[model samples]
Target: MRLLLKKKSVVLAVLLLVGGLYLINHSDFLMAGLSRSPEIHPSELTWQGQLLVSKESWVDRGQYLPLNVSYQLLAGAPATEQRYLSIGISSVNRKKGSYLISTLQSIFSMSSSEERSSMVVVVLLADFDTGWRMATLKDIKTTFALELEQGQLVVIHVPLEFYPPITGLKRNYNDAPERVTFRSKQNLDYAFLIHYCAGLGQYYLQLEDDISCAKNFLSSIRNRVAEQEKQKVTWATLEFSVLGYIGKLYKSGHLPLLARFLFLFYQEMPCDWLLTHFKLVMTQKATILFKPSLFQHMGTFSSFQGRHNKLKDKDFDDGFYTNPVAEVFSNISTYQKNFPNLAWDAGEAFFWGLSPVKGSYLTVVFKEPAVVTWIFVETGSGTKDLLQSAQVELGHDVVTTGKDKSCKDFQSVGAIENGKFEMQEVDKKYSSASKCLRILVTATQKHWVIIRKIRVTTKQSAPRQE
Candidate 1:
């Protein structure tokens, strides 16, 4: 009897715990925790509060900072005027590849001359190592000589005065755990670079020293931002990459204010952690993330001491170098002609927006009924932009003015948000109903879908993917 009672009591306790977890997850309890977070609507900020933050009383000052940093402007000049975007990269002791030069090359290679001149690469040689500093400068001077002379690559030598003067507060958490400090000086470095390059570009793009960009990454960003604007959404920061602050694109206008906000918490948190609080206090807008990650962290070695490092995303590394696309058909659907100016071309191998109207799809008409063996498709670049279900319809003939009154069985394709969307080979090859087949798409949302490349294969002919 005693044993039975004990067992029953334990079971009841477990049930109560599970019920509590369910309520917390599914009900208003979590909202209580959310309410305490710092996010505030943009309208809630007052001019006085935005402008005036007393630095003296807010936090403890940083200590054991670099005494002096030898100043060197190896290349480029200040922004002539506020440009479209400013990419701020902190090239610390990344003993890996020529991430600095290669990143610049990657940008310039993908971009047209006009696009290249539209923004500036603010490279901050921010480290205390003398040898690394000089080598970094020499390399930048040699590799990007033209960009340096053309004012496209702006390299700045960060000095001791740029940081808070020597104080008692800890700056490295690993070195001094008892006092208030950060994981690494990197938090301070980003704060320094972001503030320094605030007025340089209309929008500031935070990039890591050891990172690679995706193919047409900038174009992707421009399209995403423009789409959000079209939808009248107020976004906080647009994240181009998945890693913490890396790939985070901030409006240069907002960066100045955001930089000021971080100045108050400089000693307490990591740059990324600081961003969370900063977003809470400053704006209610949510951060926009780029799918498949535009920027990839290549540095295996951590710049900070006593830390383990791993790939930001172990599965996804595809971008400018490896991202390949197959050929697409020239014919887009003639039925739905919306946003014709920003029309999607099969050969363009990029973004395509859809209309809110149901049955909005892109179709290609084949000369003969395609005995489709395998169909390859790269869908939306975002979470919601992905197709929920794509109806693969095939028909040889159809009525134009009136309904054909024939129900067609089509292959329904579905997908999760994988970097590149490739559907499985159908159980059996699909032959067109009459002679033409249509890829009828149903979107999860009205956002654009990126059909980078679609290759259809048949038994008789080669797959025309490329």
Candidate 2:
């Protein structure tokens, strides 16, 4: 009886252990299903059709032009219940002498049977003739109305200068006067337009008049909307003239005057970098999505003259460096310069550091033209001492004058240049082993070193992986 009881107890214990392990391994899958279950019914059909649209045609200044556009659906059913489409037009009228009277017409036509979604285009015009600004606005409104009436497309006219003010501006910063008023106006307009679209349960897209739509742009956007309802992305400005980081930072509800003053003084970092660093924080708290590539620019402007019409020459000083090493070093330097008070390893700031353990780390690996860097860590006898002497290998060997061979066998290949291993007593029966290691190697220009796998080995066998 005692032996039977013991066997039953052991079996029950094993069952519980196995059940716990199963839950641990499958937790992510269960959570994903709970969080991202499809909102739309599977039986509901999606729009899967293509429409080829021409680029905006230029009209003579002071002319009220009627744009006759037609949409012939390539596939899918034009069902009234599921289809939602809105169109808008925008133009620029600020340049002198040679001005372009560009007209944009959007048709949000989608079929019910399609799988992919459709996109709405927002046209942007640059270098407009300043002399005929009102004429340009009138032309745009007229063209927009005409397209709506003729094509039966729901249309909204968004003047680039029209925006509801956030509030009556108080003189907060001294540099306010030097800022470009028109640029601010445009940004405000875009913000208001996006908010307006959101309020109406519509997705607003901004596009340049010069870019012709791919035959299936609208269809694609519609499909994307169906797949992900929370695609409410705030588009970044296409013009890089704006300078301000986009992200969240934690602070006391009531900060000391000194802390507030310091924060206000140092908040001019690039927006995308800030967004990337604090993506998790912002996503959780603010419910904002910063779509980095939503605003695609045709090309860099030769010179961008603000409202003052003075020519501004901008230089691209940060030449692209290959991969993780370059990105890590650049991000560290940028953070150090921009955010001096914040520790690099703390909170979301870990996303922007030399040894970034949080978030996704991307490194570009190349075969020929190697770049090398020495990596170090600390470990020692004391807790602080135990952390002092640990270092790891990073980078690749240098290639001279010939076609360099690719190091395909290793994800990251390097040798530990320095440090010694020591075994120290923790308690009477227990001991810990420590090693101070450094690595030296050359990184090929095109090869990438993704730090996806990290391991520490004391002997040929039984290496501990991290």
Using lDDT as the measure, which candidate wins? 1
Candidate 1 structure, TM-score to reference: 0.51
Assess each prediction's global lDDT (C-alpha) against the native.
0.54, 0.27
Q: Write the per-residue lDDT of candidate 1 for residues 251-279, one digit (tens) a residue.
A: 66566456555655666767787887766
The TM-score, computed over Cα atoms with residue i paired to residue i, of candidate 2 is 0.28
lDDT of 1: 0.54
Q: Tally clashes: model 1.
A: 9
